[model samples]
Target: MSGQLEVLNKKLKQAIDTRKVLETARKQQVDTLTNFAAKLSLSCKGMDIELDNRLAKFRSALSKGVDFENLAPLIAEILSLLKNQEAQQLSHQRELHTSVLTAGKLLQKTKGLPDDTRRMLRHLLDHQLNEIQSTNDFIPILNKLVSIYNQALNVKLSVKNTEDSITQPRLAKELLTLANDLVFEDEAADNVKAIKNKISETDSVEDLLTSAIEIIRIVATNISDERQSAQSFLVSLNQTLEDLHHSIVATSKHSESMSTEFETLNKRIESKIVNLTKQTQDATSISSLKALVDNELKSLSHDLIAKERLEQEDRQALIKNFHDINTRVGSLESKLSKYKKRLHEQRFKSLLDGLTKLPNRAAFDERFNHEFHLFSVQESDFTLVVIDVDHFKSINDQYGHSAGDKTLQVIAKALQMSIRKSDFIARYGGEEFVLLMPGMSVEHATAPLEKLRQAIKSIPFKFKNKSVQITVSVGATQFKKGDTPLIAFDRADDALYKAKKSGRDKLCINS
Candidate 1:
């Protein structure tokens, strides 16, 4: 009996020792994880102040099991921030490269010029282009280029005779053409054409130099407008991406915290089991053993009930977390949906003219192609009306670009009011608009356009408090079987030319 007792005690002691070792290992593991989290928190402080705060909170509450889930969320947030930073860095690099290339190309283009002019352009490029940090900075450099180019215009080219005296006009024309290629703004285009006209009409060096300088200024303005548009879109996209990343970090932290609490509770229950087992070894008699067992069982029952209550609380907490996650997900989805819609709107806007707020040439091409495809498949006919505002240049020259813009807007509104719901309108280019009338022939299309032309002539467009009237010439063409959009467009254009030749404000339709 004594030997049996000794053996039982020995085995029980082994069990106790085993449990103690396990508990020691568990503590070490917890300590190691806590230390790692603390180090991570400290290391991340310099990266982002807000993220560092979150990580610090996570580290502070780790011992209490309150911040258990925050580790992963913090990591995710750090990664997201890094990714965004990387993207921004990459964009900056690209812009830098572009600046270098632009300057290099400009330098090469002006290499044939006199040493003083070439040196001045190079100095502008090195000083202004190299220092460009933002779109705003970019505009000043372009302005500097405008000044340099204007000065370059006055510098005489090497001329040998009377024939070579024409070099000034020819060079001015070449420079204007190059400027046109660099910029494509509406006002810029008009100025370019006007300069080209002036270059053709005047042979004097002073007149050519004046027109050339104006072209450079117009080009600079156009470049600034383009850069601003690009920068705005980039800013909007980056902000949206940042918002999404923040939401992801928040949700991950909440989930991690819940898991930590549950783990802590389980560890406590394991410790209680070890303590109960050790107490069983103190039983000396059968009755005492039975009593000890009963007490242990009662204690266990109480613990089990407590555990059940804890489990219930945990379940409720889990459900709440799930609900929170669901709500957050809903919010994110809604935000994503709105972002998608805005993105689509931005894409649509890009296909539109900035000045007149109408669909531009790109939009017209898409619609024309779609309509042409349908014409091939469904064998349906559609008419194209190519309308041009008559004497439009005179309006811009007489009342300035603002008045010209207002006149075009009035003309566009009149065209919109005159068309049916099924018909579509697009501003093809400056002073030109295209109308697509589905299920309408050339004869049928003429009536609506004629009325639209008269309607445009009647618009009392007040520019600088002056009541101004405008007129438009219309040319209509019915899409033929096996015809391309360009072919149809050319026929309509030819008809428009005929209308302009015959008289202003008349509608001409191709047979």
Candidate 2:
């Protein structure tokens, strides 16, 4: 009986040792699981903070306006968070599996122990496995929330960008059209109407964008809430679905309203554009017809004037020829008179220009010499004028020589119109022209030259279906009693140089 008591005691001691080992293993497993849960919770909290920060930044961007380009980075961060969560959960499961396997091995080693103790150890291991599986299930739902949130944010950003892009150009076009219409319209009511239409169109787009932003904000908040409640993923997902359904309904209503507003605004703009287009077409037609009629009238008037000028020129030529005949007849009666008569006629013809039939440089030189001789004899004064066209070469090069020639003729005609009948004009060469006035001072010559300058400047010469404008520089010098023709010419040339240097298209007088 004493021997039987000793064996029972040994069995009791072994049982106590097994319980101690199991207890120690259980505590270690609990500690490991607790540490893992703590770490996972910390990671989750960190993820939450990061998500919050990202959302805040996104909100800030949305408040100002969403940037589509930034959406990719947001998505990348969310994906990284999901991957990290998944990896952590997987690691936790692996650790738990390893712990369970180690506990199973410890149980197998104590197979000789009573069944109740073995069952208790198995129950604890099963509970831990169930907890680990629950946490694992939670992780995928969290990742899905993250993905949904990212997708929603991306969609919002895309819509915002698209809306802005669409609206901006329309606003700009409306503003420009309104400004143009306002400038063109004579009536105050018309200007007000255009301005109001532009404002309405601009406002409609802005209001649409504002509504879209509000909707996006609502959706983002809902998604954010769903992300935070990872354990209740299904419930959160259901709530999100409800929110989405409500959003869709609201969006449909908003779209209908927006469509109505757009239709109204579009109709108004289209009507205005049509009306303006018709008005522009009518104005253009009237302008073209008026231009044609005016051109015809101008042609008729020019023909009449040219005919009268030709007749007058012919009479003058006839008179000149008749006078020459009378002089020749008188000279034929005497030997010395014939030579003198031929010389005078030759000199007179040499003094005249071939083109424009105006006085040439020879005439100006002869007149200047005679005048200076007279001034020296009588102390009288006379002015010499010189004119040069500006950028004549460029015009010739750009528009061809024919245009240049037409430009020259137009300027010559303009000069004739501007100058006094007594003023003698000449085409000096290529683009240089000259004028001379007898019995006039430099100050007196300025008026006619300036008139010619301004007239030429204002008159638009039509060439190759384009209106071309040109300017000229003029210089004048008053002849002194003692001045020779060369001296007067040099002084005029110097004044012309000064005129060109000061800036072309101005009159300069020799001091």
Candidate 3:
């Protein structure tokens, strides 16, 4: 029994050792699976849920005392998942590398950007694209790229716009050609020329640092050297523009003053003519002369011969006075004719607008007064049309004043073509035009004016390589008896205001 007990204790000890070995092996397998799963969790940061679930199932099997037969397959499946994850990671890495390279190329292509801005773009391209490890992280970088691109494009467009406005293309091209030749000839340093040549070969911003710094320094030195000259030119330009504006305003005022003075002088001459004609008619009246002659005979001698002689002398004296008065009136009429001729030929020319070659406000005033007088005398029908260019200020603002001038010219031409020879057109002021249609009532004038409105709208105005449409608001009114020309004009102007307020490009008649 002692021997049997000792044999059992030995067997028990051996069995315990074997069990310890098996338990150690089982722990190692669990640890291996756990370590693999942890590695997969780290690698599959954004992996599919199916893969995660499979990994969870393998872990659950391991925790439930999985046999080697089952454990081996689970491990094999885990190994397969790991391989696929690695391949996916490799593909993502390659894609990221390719994207970074693409960004580098884009950075290289960008030119004329300031150093700080270019550096900011490069920093984003280099760091942002590289740090992205998954699809979810790519969006911000793409959006950042779009913003950077827009900023760069805006800067380029602004610079181009300013350059185009300030510099004439043909002159700028010539100047640039001359500058290039002078730069090459005047450059004394071989190192600078070599650096410039090197920079000229490359389009990349990264490769241009040294050349750009040197160019900036040279530009700074040149600017410092020419600062006084540049300031003088700028001052001269500003002074010239101011002088031009002042001159225009002063000339307009002077023209208006001259027109008013001429009108006053004409009225004075007409009044003098009327007074002289009345005096002549009163002196030559038959009843007044007979009464005067009868009184003179009563006071004269009773003898027939003396009375006849006195009567004959009085008749000759009266004839002489009448002849003298006629001669003076003829001279005055001749002088008035010459004055009218001079006014039409010379003064009216000044009253014409230089831009559109249309009659200006001064001329318009004279014509308006003449028409008013004619209407008063003949009682003929007449209409005044006041047309205003719509949003003219915006056209000038968007496309320089030159373009605005062109638009005015085109509109003026169109109006001239649309109107009859008897009708008169004038540039009343800045963007306002007046038309005088005589012998035509408001109803008769509307059709032609509407046609003119349509013609103006149809003109496809092109300025600086851009297409624009033009429209006008028209006002029409008939001349009424006992109403001043100015009052009639105001009514037409009011109609024009209504037309403009009511979406423009239509005719508003206030008759």
Best by lDDT: 1
Pull out the clashing pairs in model 3.
none
- Candidate numbers, best TM-score first, in rank order: 1, 3, 2
| Tens digits of lDDT, candidate 1, 1-511 | 9999999999999999999999999989998988887886686576556666666766777756754565677668766776775576568766765865575466547534667767766776657566756545656666656665665544423323444676754574455334323324466556675665666556677787787688778757766875886577667656655655665565567557656765776766677677667866766777887887787678777767776876787677667656765765666576667767866876786676654667777888998899999998987879988999999767756765556656777777777889999998988876789999999888877777778888888887777788777788888899998788889999999999999999978899886
Look at candidate 1 and give me any clashing residue pairs.
69-256, 69-257
Clash counts per candidate, in order, are 2, 0, 0
Tell me the lDDT of model 3 at 222: 51
lDDT of each: 0.73, 0.63, 0.72
Cα displacement (angstroms), candidate 1, residue 306, comes to 3.4
TM-score of candidate 2 relative to the true fold: 0.33
Where does candidate 2 stray beyond 4 Å?
1-349
Residue-by-residue lDDT tens digits, candidate 2, 293-349: 565556556555655665565566556555654554444445335445755765565
Mind giving the per-residue lDDT tens digits that candidate 3 earns over 301-365?
Answer: 33344445545655665565456546555655665576568547655556777557798777899
The best-first sequence of candidates by lDDT reads 1, 3, 2
